[model samples]
Target: MTTREWAGDAETRQVTEVASERELRELIGEPNDRAANKIRSRLHDLDRQWLARSPFCYLATADAEGRCDVSPKGDPAGFTLVLDDATLAIPDRPGNKRLDGFRNILANPQVGLNYVLPGRSDTLRINGRGRILRDAPFFDDMVVKGNRPRLALLVEIDEVFYHCSKAFLRSQLWQPESWQPDAVPSRARIAKGIEAPDIPLEQLEAHYGAGYADRLYG
Candidate 1:
């Protein structure tokens, strides 16, 4: 079916867009003092402390043409290296390695990060300029499970702040009762359905089953 048919008649639909900063500000109002003044150009002691406990983060990058990607990075707590108040480094690990975000960093240095700690509603956010390093003097310090990262993304901070937890609260993210893993297909089934239609479902299931965890760091 055509898009107009799928979305119903466009002329009869209420489609409103906030087109400019003036309209957006008029709708949401200006930020109060605390929210407006909270942006920082360097990481504070509190930010460092938060990084020490955060095991996961989402790396946001966009290429010169403005295509974007958000890649998830995780390790044991404190995986990120805080080189100084303005500089930070994230070690790379093995994966399918499409290198979408890394390629974006090559084309555009601007990057953003959202750090998360398990069971925590609030998040730490950073906006910075990023560069990829094949090797660094501190790489030895980033060793994990007998594996030393061969690459790391270094970021020079431009802004840092703690994000509020309202989204998490509204979604009940931390409440176990809100989880419904079975609401969607399993990983194997999903791979077969969307990515590998020709592959046998049983093979995909086995690939994602008992031995899957063993290949995480391999």
Candidate 2:
């Protein structure tokens, strides 16, 4: 589709775009002074506590060319190790070997992480530089089911803060009654369109399910 068609129309595009920070700030108004001041350049004790209780987080990274990706990382609570006030170590669990986000981190050290807990509305956000570590000591600490990760992402903190609960409140994300059931296509089904079409759907599902069910750890 053409740019104009994809963006709705010229008027819609013009209305949505704010060309400069000045213009954007004018539209949204200044952020809260207290909120702005709350952002820490390092992880504090409270931040460490939050990470300790978080079983899931989203790791966001962008390549040198600015191509971005967000990948979900989850484990038991406290799976992410706070190596100190300034560093965090996240084990790179076994997966399909795409490594899109990890490759982006190699090209561009900058990364963002958002930590979430099951019933909590507020999420902790961490912005930092990342490096891949394959050292035995790093992997030794993150072993799961006798399987140690072959690699870990070490993050040096730059900014850390708690995002407000407005988003979760608006979506009612934690409320079961607010959720709607839907039939979601499996990854195998989606891949068949662009990949191995000759593979039977049942075979693909069986393989995929078994991998997730039995081989989650590396």
Candidate 3:
């Protein structure tokens, strides 16, 4: 595959530097002026539903140069391992090819997460320090999609917060009774873009069907 270009350029967004860590901490003392409610949260805050019911999550991380990648992971509820009052471990399942997110974690452990419920409006956001592990019992714990995951990532919860689901509420994310998939992007279209030297479209798809089950279940 060719190098993928970023959709947005740096010039598109305004960037500003906060003076210092100490200055930012000092500023957190004052309460919010927004409304009678919706106050900013502290580190120790833990919302139960955020951990218990989320079947899907997005992980965001960047390298030292600020080039970033966000990866999506999903499983049944309780797939994530709560290492403690302050840590979480998400098992890395099998994938098609790339390992961009895992590589970024090695370069910069600073990471962020957005956890969304299947049909719930509210979402949880967590920013934490993380590391990747490739050991046994840990992998065996979060196993799903059949085989044990080869690797798992652990994140120390430095911050935990939630977004009021105005966007989701308005869009009726919980109204799954009206949901629809956008489309099935064809392998031909994808191969035309990536110029993968794999095979003809029919053969490629057949290979996926025949090869995937054996690798995952064989």
Q: Which pairs of residues have clashing backbones in candidate 1?
A: none
- Where does candidate 2 clash, by residue pair? none
Give the alpha-carbon lDDT of every model. 0.93, 0.87, 0.74
Candidate 2's residue-wise lDDT over 94-182, tens digit each? 78799999899889999999999998999999999999988757678788888788889999999999998999999999999887644
The model with the greater TM-score, 2 or 3, is 2
Indicate the worst ten consecutive residues by lDDT in candidate 3: 36-45
Worst window of 10 by summed lDDT in candidate 1: 1-10
Please report the candidate that would top TM-score against the real structure: 1
Estimate, for each residue in 1-218, the C-alpha lDDT of model 1 and write its tens digit: 11232346545554466678888888889998999999999999999999999999999999999999999999999999999999999999998989999999999999999999889899999999999999989999999888898799999999999999999999999899999989999999999999999999999999999999887778
Assess candidate 3 and give its TM-score to the true structure: 0.69
TM-score of each: 0.93, 0.87, 0.69
User: Once superposed on the true structure, which residue ranges of model 3 sit more than 4 Å away at CA?
Assistant: 1-46, 170-184, 192-198, 207-218
Q: What are the per-model numbers of colliding residue pairs? A: 0, 0, 0
Candidate 3 lDDT by residue in tens digits, 138-213: 6767766566777889888777777778999788767867676446555555774577656667766665555655
Instruction: Give candidate 1 misplaced runs (Cα > 4 Å).
Output: 1-14
